[model samples]
Target: MSADRVVQLRWEPRHVADDGRVELSYPGISVVSSRQGEVVDRKWVPVGEEPTFADDEALIAVLHAAWRWTRPAA
Candidate 1:
């Protein structure tokens, strides 16, 4: 039998502001949540399908996600 694999997912958030933007993000995703826990902006990548990648490719995707979340609303 093949070994069932599972990847952990996590979300990080920054403090809330009157501007209604909470810096929410995951390992390979970007998201913006409101003070009311409403998701206004978000990003998700389909990594589950692959479950494997070259070292650089995996790192780059993670970096891009983080950049998107912290990016200055461009």
Candidate 2:
């Protein structure tokens, strides 16, 4: 059996800028999106570990998951 890894995402509202793009920040990760909600850039704190940018599909999946996770229960 394989265990699933849970990613804890923490968004910092203070870091948000006037730009159309939205910035989501976690412990050591940051995801930036375009005004239309397309991911434009991604970065890791301290740098130099993995690729800075993520695949479009992967980024979308993560954003969707995060939205669902934060949505209020009906």
Candidate 3:
């Protein structure tokens, strides 16, 4: 069987605002993934409005799903 994969969002302590907005940092919001306890992918999230995602890439997909619970409907 293939190793179980996991996706995680990591950021610095003060880099994220109380409103869930991320400030400009060297490595903005980090989209990290690992399989079998080993890191396999890492990417920076593009700057955008809080609680909304425009990218459909695999990494960004996770963020989209998570934001659904936090943001109100338009």
Candidate 4:
């Protein structure tokens, strides 16, 4: 089996401009949409050494598996 790897994620709240535009995207990321109490949609944000994935669902699945695998015995 391949060696285990650690992942990290960093999130920073975006700043809104006086013209009602909020900057939700980072330098290499894209912000699809943002609304009050609805959702802050984004394309994808890079979290680690790997290149950013076009689809975040895959990343979410990997994280879910890691969480379950590393949990303490019940």
Candidate 5:
């Protein structure tokens, strides 16, 4: 069996508007996976909007899906 992973995410504003709508920088989503309190894996993705995940697994799944969808046709 594998240890459970926990995800941590951070968002930084790319641009701040007068109306208070901030544009998150491309690849704004930073996903960090930790196991036993030690980070194991990390990835970045341009979600294009604020993303919320219930847990690390959810975040990872969404990132992978987004990446696949955005990849150029081969």
Candidate 6:
């Protein structure tokens, strides 16, 4: 198992702008998604280390993840 603890939050696309892609992905060690009007989307398992900016090595990885996840223009 990976050293990083998976952090999952219920999916809320609105809430996902920041670290939301983590929630939108297919297998987040943790998953957070839309739960409105009594509807449930398929769940995902999220897994990743809590990124630390102070550490140069992990910082790059975190940044890349963030960059890849930006939402498209509506």
lDDT of 3 by residue, 1-74 (tens): 23355667887332445556755333346766666677767666554444344544644666665444234354
**Model 6, runs deviating above 4 Å:** 1-54, 71-74
Candidate 6: deviation at residue 61, Å? 0.6
For residue 26, give model 3's deviation from the true position in Å. Answer: 3.9
Residue lDDT tens for model 5, 15-71: 445566764345456766666688767666545444556444565686675444334
Report the C-alpha lDDT of model 6 over 1-74, residue by residue, as the tens digit.
12122223443222244464554323232232222233223333333455344444443454444333332233
Using lDDT as the measure, which candidate wins?
Answer: 5
Top candidate, metric TM-score: 3
**TM-scores for every predicted model:** 0.26, 0.29, 0.41, 0.27, 0.39, 0.23
Winner on TM-score between 3 and 6 is: 3
Stretches of candidate 5 off by over 4 Å are 1-4, 12-27, 49-60, 63-74
Question: Per-residue CA lDDT of candidate 1, range 1-74, in tens?
Answer: 11121122345333435556655332343333222344444444433335666644765665555444444453
**Which whole-number lDDT from 0 to 100 does residue 34 have in model 1?**
28
Pairs that collide in candidate 4 are: none
Please list all clashing residue pairs in model 3, or write none if there are none.
Answer: none
On TM-score, the stronger of 2 and 6 is: 2
| Model 1: how far residue 45 lies from native, Å | 16
Clashing pairs in 2: none
Go through the candidates in order and give the C-alpha RMSD of each one to the true structure.
Answer: 16.1, 13.8, 11.9, 12.6, 10.7, 16.1
Worst 10 residues of 4 by lDDT: 1-10
What does candidate 4 score on TM?
0.27
Model 4 bad stretches (over 4 Å):
1-54
lDDT of each: 0.42, 0.42, 0.55, 0.42, 0.56, 0.35
